[model samples]
Target: MLVRRFKKSLLVLSIAASATVAHAESFNRIASFGVIHNLPEGTEQSQETSPEIIAASEDGNTLVYSDSPFEALGFVDISDAKNPVAGGIVKLDGEPTSVAIGGKTVFTAVNTSKSYTQPSGYLMALGLQERDELVRCDLGGQPDSVAVSKDGRYVAVAIENERDEDLNDGEMPQLPAGWVTIVPVENGQLQCDKMTKVDMTGLAEIGATDPEPEFVDFNSRNEIVVTLQENNYLAIIDAASGKLVNHFSAGSVELQGIDTKKDKMLDFTDSQTRLREPDSVKWLDDNRFVIANEGDMNGGARGFTIFHKDGRMLFESGASFEHQVILAGHYPEKRSGKKGSEPEGVAIGQFDGETYIFILSERASVIGVYRDTGDAPEFVQLLPSGMAPESAVVIPQRNLLVSANEKDLIEDKGPRAHVMLYSLTDAPAAYPQIISTRTSEGTPIGWGALSGLTADPAKPGMLYAVNDSFYANQPTIFTIDANQTPAKITAATLVLRDGKTAKKLDLEGIAADGQGGFWLASEGKTSKEIPHAIHHVNSTGEIDRTIDFPKALLANEKKYGAEGITLIGDTLWIAIQRPWKDDPADQVKLLAYNLKTNSWGAVRYPLESAATGWVGLSEIVSHGDQVYIIERDNQLGESAVVKRLYSVSQDQLKPAAIGSDLPLVKKVLVHDFMPDLKSLNGYVQDKIEGFTVDAAGNGFAITDNDGVDDSSGETLFFSIGKM
Candidate 1:
């Protein structure tokens, strides 16, 4: 199977033709703006904040986004589009739900409702140049979305008198029912006196008397399209007269090849029936528009749909979009029980005489780009978004795209909520740097959390990687074709013990045995009863032996145990993650087990000290007369400092018997991986867990994604060229 997969990958490479185009257009992320930076001077840094919806000024110099947690509208200056600056925030009396730009003014919908039963909201128009409120009008109910007409003569707001989920399983019919509010504007100046309340009652089949509108958008003809998300309905209204033009059920869809359980693994074989609840709607033209089906009540189709203004369905994405997300390794397995990928928000923009549709996956944290062909949209590429992307806005004039992500991990001390900016330039795509190809059975390789890496001794550019314990139920080794663009995982082999799949083993390191097998390092935490051990497995992935830590070493063991392993002739050297008991400060033991003698010995290695956090070893590999190791700090984002690769001479590895005074090994700095990690234009990730030198002397590194659990689920795999 390995030979067959390798030959197939080579065939693909052989048949592909390279073209040298002088101009290549692609979107590349240039800057990321954290929402916490826009907080007032006195505000606490730990306060949670998020940017849910975003809009940009006419000249594409200013960005405004709604921050519900901070009860304000955060601003960013993008005059230098490559570098964005915090422009402060505007505190409001209520939670801002959405924002839109109209010439020199910004319109925001603020929800001030005290309870679900008695709802109230307000629409405020703020001057863009002065950053001050120009006018405010009572919107009768809590608003969910806001939009401005292209001509800058009208503003539309979707009043969603949302029900409390704690009340009766969150079934609809909770009153002070919702409606659409249309107001007149002249030269970007708000005219609140001309507001008209358009009743949206009896428009949806479910909860007909209490319509909860979710999103609103205006077409070139001044016609407004609204989505009643919870009720599974879409309605069109003539803004000039505030009268309903047409309405229809958003409609159900049948999906196959989907995983519908939270099973800690990716298996797209399940099927779903009749799911329609659409959330955000955007106009494609005067007669067509698209709706993102992010279910609220009983359905989430996991895709988007296009429809004509006269209630005609033009196209339904069904499971197509989510399939691409699955292939990209961005599918959120934890969200399988609810909505897979959850297509929530969408933005359509015309650039370079072509229309592009951007769909946001709230759970997967990716954006699917599609070109409008006037039929089924053409899939272009997928862009990596921050965690929980809720909305997006495009600035075609400046060739820019922005996403507003709403997940702030202040309590968890993880990466904060960010607004990512991408520029459309004449360059190649930079994301999805590593992905898996489909197997012969037409299923994705389904690999993630790549913790350890090692190259095949005979096959150049061919590597093997292991997944960490995040997929506890499925420990597997993957075969990668590193020579391919973006690198491809070609096959997966399940690690087995006693004829059954291995469990409770946090396999973090891999090294090829001289006899067509491998030695794997397992990290241990005594509290969980998982011991630090080494397993010897055959080429077919069947475990032949398991070696436990020496009793003397176990007596001084700590939670941070073995992280990496490598073979040097008849000896297996393992990297201990951090300083264990009985060890000196800023030093860790490199334990060695003899394959033939069955004896244990050790040597101490000095670790770089970190100013804010502890530094530790993540991976190790034996190449030439040296052992290369990855040492990094457990800090994320801008706080990360010590992600470096170092090498120690084999001659200095003078190991002493267990329980004896081990000699310290001197190391040489090989490279600092900070610049490579930041090349994607995102906050630096902390887990640089894998490193290996291939048979051709090329070096490669990979990061662990923690199985996309409480993470954006981005796996970085790149080559550091020659060692």
Candidate 2:
């Protein structure tokens, strides 16, 4: 009896011990896939093998990892977390530059191997279910990356040659040269067909250089795409024949140390070339795509890049980015902080009568307010969100506040991801903690944390994002809806996918259009430096169009990024974050395409030098007879938010042309103070994002703390008496 009693006690203790250990293990938050892409420095095209992550799947089902630092393949089964199990390891002959996955299919892009003697690898396809080798197609020279067709019928592989040690940086590669291999997935048919070499060297010869090739993707018919790179440019290509259609240049970067590794967050630079790190690309409909870039501006500033599928230089603006994160201590020369301040994630949404843009600032734990009337959106600051607000958005009818907590964008502090939901009670503007992705049942899936977010009424649902990786990589996208209660997720999608074409998205930015489409922007910062693009997936998950911006405009604009893409009435407006020398005055264009005119015009916002008391353009809106613009401090951080109003006469854009300086409406004031900031983000936190006019003819705008750190953030509303 004594022995039995002792055994029972011991057994109980053992069970309790085991339970304690299990509880001690931290629950993996949302996986953050590095949002930015980093490549080897200089002209030497070497991709990191292990130290980086490409993309991650939703549901935390799978992960597509690369060891460009070691040039190998790593697969992890994220299904049973608490601790993700390493699925298996595959040794590649060369560097696996990019990877994508869908369902059970995995596609990987292998570049020049470190072994040197081994034949340059092309692309490998593997089936995750059977652990079977689907196919390993070889290629000549070195391939940049691969893209699969929507139906999984074709794979578009962008290939290039190794830099000749003896040749100068400007000289072209003569060996295998540059080409996109369109191979049939079933039998690898491209091997037998006469090899087709499309001359993408046009952008190169003209100075787009070291091109980062990209595709907006194709469905059943011929898919059109845009390619970008330094000295090269944004080019429209015929997917079938590898034929050059049309394109525009982003600019040039001379022979220098252009490191693709140190890049942390999105900034002012080209996506394809060197200005920005080109990590991912998404098609925003069929005509345009948003490219997320991560890199140090090679003499240019850093940010995201936008391009037309037909290779037109869309427009780049500093006002577009959700936010930028530079390492706390590491910065290029004197360009560390935003005018000396740090910024975080940018949240935007629509609510109430007036358009309100709320900004969440780190440290200070406050929210920035940008109020928009008929004129431009004004700026102000308020206390909302939590201690550290990562990202925020506003629900249409229900005036509630939602926020993503990303500890800190630059420091890599605290937990990976956290979120706070708040509401505007009859009391005052105070935010309380609501939902969290880190709970045992919650899935933060934020690779780095939370980066950018926007809402589309078309889905009638809500979406939240974690900066999954790139900036830190492992990022994830979590979605919520109006019907959902706090802490509840209606639907969600992983950040990574099995790319059918040559596009492996490192999800960075999000834009939703009223027309039933959600836009996802990616940052690709590897060898090509291709500009970022905006991808629009319909209700059924089919991409319609993508607007590819020229790589030249990307590099020259300082960064080729379309941080924020929106529809102001029928016209499409894009914001390019960084312009050339971080000088907003250098012509960060606000390109407007008038659906009625069937033409496009540039509205230049001299951002860097726009301190003339005039509001520099960003977080733009068109309300009936008046044009609303928000000038969030791009260079000076957020010391002052100058929300200036401009009137665009319906008659001015008609037969005649009313370009940049149309007319200032001093009387028609929108937001008066620097409304887009939380106290912590300092002057840099006020980045106004979402804006719109509702049925009441009242304008609604939402702002967020640029994901600088994670406190709490908020979404405010204002009343725009009438249109």
- TM-score per model over all chains: 0.95, 0.37
Compose the digit string of candidate 1's lDDT tens values, residues 1-723: 000000011111110011111236878789888888898998899989989999999899999999998999999999997788999999999999999999888999999988888888899999888888899988878888999999998999998888777778877788878889999998777778899889989877799988988899999999999988888899999988999999988878878778898987778888987557888899999999999988877899998888888887887777878877777778888888988888998999999999999999988888888878887777777888888889999999999999998988878878899999999988887878888877686655677788999999988899999998888778899998999767888888899999999877989999998677999999987789888899989999999999999889999988998899999988999999999998998899999998899999999999998999799999999999999999999998888999999999999887899789989999999999999989998878899999999989999999988776677888889999998
Please provide, for model 2 over 1-723, each residue's C-alpha lDDT reduced to its tens digit, 9 standing for 90 to 100.
000000011111000100011111111122221211222235132222232323344333555555554465555554543234545556666676555554456677777544322336666776655645666767664665455665656667666444443446435433334556666654422232444556665455433334435422453455645444323345556666677666655432221211223344333232222343232344444565544332212323233334555554343322221221121111221222322111222333445455554544333344444443323333322333333343343433444444433332323222222233334334322221112222233222112233444544444334443242334322344453323222223344443333322234544455556565555555444345544555655543445655554443344444344444445566665544445443344445555445456555444444435453333344444446655554444332323445433334433333212232422123235654343333222222344543444434544333443343342232222233354
- Pairs with steric clashes in candidate 1: none
Supply candidate 1's per-residue lDDT for 205.
79
Error of 2 at 689 (Å): 34
Instruction: Estimate the TM-score for candidate 1.
Output: 0.95
* Model 1 lDDT at residue 252: 83
- Kindly report which residue stretches of model 2 are placed more than 4 angstroms away from their true locations once superposed: 1-60, 80-83, 112-119, 162-176, 187-197, 203-226, 251-280, 293-299, 311-313, 319-723
User: CA RMSD for every model?
Assistant: 6.1, 26.0
